[model samples]
Target: MQKDIYVVGMMVDERGSKAPDVQQVITRYGDKILCRNGIPSPSRERGIITLTMEATPEDYQRMEQDLKGLKGVTVESIHFSQPESFQLCENR
Candidate 1:
């Protein structure tokens, strides 16, 4: 399994959909998605909402593909964690 962590920033049209759609997104993504949230941003259009989801590298690509197909939602940015090699440390 890949250890890389991916954080995706998303923007969705908050109109025309019921509140349950948000929950559906989370349910669809399921276990591969570690964290998901929809945050309202007043600085922009009232209907524009910010969403964030975190996943492993493999899961990120799959999740992105799925989300991209959904209407009215746009992926703003995908942040990837740097790869690092490490030896076992004495401290746990």
Candidate 2:
């Protein structure tokens, strides 16, 4: 499978009402998401979310598009075509 790593940033301007819609979009791409982190403002009227996703380029684009389609939501992404292999540990 051709997999790329994606870092998605989402801003919810109207958290109270837009949150449910944003949640739905995120849920639709649940399997592709590796990690999610969300931060709500002090007043809780806005939220910022970051997501790490492992999926094909097409899937990432689809997700980005879905999020962008929502009202009061802004989305952006950083994509890296994952290398074939990488070492996660250093030699002892």
> Which 10 consecutive positions of candidate 1 have the poorest summed lDDT?
44-53
Q: State the lDDT of candidate 1 residue by residue for 12-46, as single tens digits.
A: 66534633464466477676555556555545442
Give the per-residue lDDT of model 2 (tens digit) for 17-76: 898899999999999998999997768888999999988888888888989999899998
Measured with C-alpha atoms, the lDDT of residue 58 in candidate 1 is 68
Model 1, residue 69: C-alpha shift (Å): 0.8
Question: For each predicted model, how many residue pairs clash, with residues at least 3 apart or on different chains?
Answer: 0, 0
Looking at model 1, residue 32 earns an lDDT score of: 55
**How well does each candidate superpose onto the true structure, as a TM-score?**
0.57, 0.86
Whole-model lDDT values for every prediction? 0.56, 0.87
Off by over 4 Å in 1: 16-19, 41-54, 82-92
Model 2 stretches astray by more than 4 angstroms: 85-92
